[model samples]
Target: MNTTTIDKPATTANAPGGPVPVCHVIKGRVVTGTDVEYGPARARFATPALDLDGMVWPRREPGPAFDVPLAEIMDVLVQTGERLTRDPDGLLAEALEFSVLTSPLPRSVLERSYASLGRLFNRRSMEFQVQQELGGADVLDGWREVDGAPSGRRHRTRAFPPRLIHVIAGNAPGVAALSVVRGALTKGVHLLKLPSNDLFTATAILRVLAAVAPGHPVTRSFSAAYWRGGDEKVEGLLFRPQFFDKLVAWGGESTIRGARQYIGPGFELVAFDPKTSISLIGREAFESDAVLADVAERAAADATIMNQQACASSRVQFVEAGVQDVDRYCALLQARLGVERETASACGNPLASDLRDEIDGLRDMQPHYRVWGGYEGRGLVIRSEEPVDFHPDGRVVNVVPVASLDEAVHHANVATQTVGVFPASRKVALRNALAAAGAQRVVALGQAAMFETGISHDGFYPLQRFVRWVNDEG
Candidate 1:
């Protein structure tokens, strides 16, 4: 309810000579102050101080959102989605301009990502997610009878909304929107700790909801702000179960490690652990020239999207091909990596000097290793008998020649989130083996980033972990 001049230059990144005011939305209220803070040195940008006091709800019982009808929340979300698509207030536009300074994504790619936020809020998507993930909306609304009990007693259960603190990732701006939608759909009181890389999208989406339905319980259930990760002063006070029920964290090892220290008996950690994706190319790709070209393009899509920054982007590919065919596929994939797409740019961030040096060292090793492309962001592919020792990034892909696709399974483990397989049909044969090896999702080549609704992420249906199941028996 606090009134601030949102249209003034002082409120946006385009401000004449000051750091932009990154305000916090606390339970349907906006709180802004004069304190200044900067993001990471690599992508530094200034923002106003976080309103820490406004973050936590006072009582232990559920907030107003717990009592709201499921149908009503859906309507408000659908309307909010419509408004987000139109971007009537230009918040999304302003956020995009601000985000480019913090995020590594190109302006065009960021625009496309922000443009897709509206689809997540639609009625059909929401209904399907609830039905598929939690069984149905009825379970969330109230208790439902269970059909069987060994004791011959009838029982009922509800997917009770939990108090969640989401440490959302910023690799792609869509994560902020998705987190907001999921939190609201589960009817939880969510405090989103926005990542420095994407400081605006979550707040922008929350503002859209606030405008669409002022004072609505669904809108009131949400809040978002930023703080340096691992700030003990802030985390020490809020991480207890009395204030929150779960810490839904997404980031690399360091981020997850920081959150792990706070976990205990009452509060749980639902971690989207750090993961890398890979690709498997069967012998079918080399059957014909046309087929090989098509397969290379598909492989490029999985490896180059988001400039290999996304967890789902393929960093390593195991191709069942000879020396000549594997080299040919590498060339085709390198050319396709620099092309523009909805989620990728023509040119991406340059490869790091260390990674470049490693690739340079491989040049002297004869038939054991072959390199194609360069470090200029047009994409780089290194073919070797084994995976590289260093992590691949900046549109760089490590291609390994495997005797068979089955051999690729040995390289997969708990840290592998996705495995993109060529010859779409090959997925059926490899999915079971891949899953046993700890890979959560086996996607068809080119479709690693194109996730379907109601599917599991990082080995589990997230919504199932986000809520508490309570049962009553008679």
Candidate 2:
């Protein structure tokens, strides 16, 4: 670890009784100004404005990071991570304190999230990701000989670092950290457009890198700022291929659709499209009272990760059970949803009014549909003969009864990102069918939100897409 003394800089400058000042980081330097802009108002607090033009890096050439060895970059990141964990009142802490105002997640949940942010920067974990995704670190450092080619000619290739504008999602604070780590490991020049929901995390991490290794290539390669998603003045000029090679977007339908128009010949979009996850519970869960309790807890774990705000959190569960068994499972699942966990809180943003109304309507539908729990974020479970019409959220899980596990596959489509299956053994039987049905990942019933390092996200390895492949022909 670097063990450098960290300075506690004010993240925001509040002008007496005015809105907080949100500053922009250009490369490794922080730039603050009097120019004011406010983000869309949320339930809790409003976002402070930033200088958008200051964030634009006019240089067209690659930065020093493009030439540095991958190992050196990893070392800087590891030290930065250590510093993040060790510092009691550092940038990560500052971000957590500010997050309470901008984010809907409770204080305890945010504390838990900030505490684990350092783990994403592990050295061996990063090495594994590089090896798994891009074959090895050698390709990133320089060109390597092609193993097999159809033509009788020698060729070499390198995974060139791209100039990227990451439109990162703010649902999980971890996304910001992961983007920085990925951007650094790939040696890319990253300009992260911070989401309104999470405005501080990425900038704080970048600031830590600046403190740990001042003027380091990795630090100079990163810049983070905030601007509304569809701001044409900024997007119209910056989205061009001359400025950035790709826009890595992570958000819902509106965010993706907004970024699509900017894609063209030189610039492209690597989209982590909005996706929903489901669960398939085998009848074996009901084999015994102890088994049912354990299964319910597992199902709840998947359903309530990040309070069902994460893309991997299970929303709809298909169970191979009769009415009595399924109803019992729903009751148990509802109770478990309110239990606190590392990534979830006992309560979250209350269920949306429309969703609450939908549940209320289902209540009158009687035997055809049964609703458990309510809108206060204690979690809600609805048991129905078929899938519900509205999307489940706010720790809500819809339990759909099916005669066989195979019947659940029909409900999954291209939008499905993960499917957690019970009885672990059944995953093998359903993995192929689930993938064929357009689902990207399958895991044990309780492991939907537990992702391993180097795993593919949204059906592709993101790090592979973050770089450009340049070849040398001989």
Candidate 3:
């Protein structure tokens, strides 16, 4: 492991320092790291030089390693942990202000960010700013009854101002931003271990935070830095009794499994779990054939975002029998996939290698699973000649063949994350069935990922899962 440093004054707004290097609390010691820029995104780290915008960018003159001793490192972690477990109010106020500023992010760019975490981190920053400056709308309040209160006596409430250890996965962008914002709601001191794939987010967010609250101690309540997620030298050293109160993670099977190393008695593990999504078409989709084509165009739009890598993006599809009538459905979907040309978006890191590996293995067995669109950019589509298999691949899309709407509902297994139902009525049957089948979200066939703020990801109303509530039992 290379321990690198650079001399950067804290006044430089371009990265992490200009006069004094902007800081975040980790454990509670003042360990410093500088910003490393990459393409359109930037992150904070102690690395001397970095790959930025297709060139090598070194922030400052290199120097010898700063081994401040393990004991000191322990103090930073312990102190920050103590701050979160003991007093979180002041820090939360600052975090809230920053989170509110993040809501105005463009859906288009948000779509492009995909696995390149810097963009996702940017997304998180966008959400963080919105929450900090404007406070996101109360998600749970949308279902008010005539009296404007809980529908019945089911008015139960819980508040968890818990300290957190965020295990961010490099799989998607903006994930770290989400975890960071969640920690801030508790005003909890944070120990952020950056995933190797998208390391720039913490720096971008911290730099922004320092600018937003230059002198606030809440800035000291969190320590956001970059380190490999599986470096057990660091993990074994820090994932102990007094270091954290909760471990929050987002990713696939390996990531969630790896995060468990830091979990025990007082420190709990909260995971997003492994998930997937798809679309459902209804016969009413052809209320008019032209309308069906428009719906087909929009459905293609939903699938193209982030190249359908998101758990919220559609992958497994079910079409109505009466509309395209199975054969026509496949033909229409393929035509739509070709016409809409969803595979044209920019991408990074090429989706997950594991997903690609899965496709590589399956394509050898299923000839129908051939790549059917332009083979560059986000222009590749995968279609099934048989019920074959659905292994997600790089910017590759799949159009699964189902016998009927009823069979479509039958296929709503545990892998479903979001399902877009056309005609919207079939949703009455398919949505609940898929919900029972383990889906996290359901939407109009074309609006899978664009369901507004409160629609729910997995099972949590984000505000509830990501924030704190003070209830005075007066």
TM-score of each: 0.95, 0.94, 0.62
Report the candidate with higher lDDT, 1 versus 3: 1
Supply the global lDDT for candidate 1: 0.86
Give lDDT: candidate 3, residue 418. Answer: 79
What C-alpha lDDT values do all the predictions have?
A: 0.86, 0.85, 0.49
Q: Please report how far candidate 2 places residue 263 from its true position, in Å.
A: 0.5
Best-first order by TM-score:
1, 2, 3
**Local distance difference test, candidate 2:** 0.85
TM-score of 1: 0.95
Off by over 4 Å in 2: 1-18, 40-54, 58-60
Off by over 4 Å in 3: 1-160, 286-288, 322-371, 385-387, 451-455, 461-474
Question: In candidate 1, what residue range of length 10 has the lowest lDDT sum?
Answer: 1-10
Best by TM-score: 1
Deviation (Å) of 213 in candidate 3:
0.7
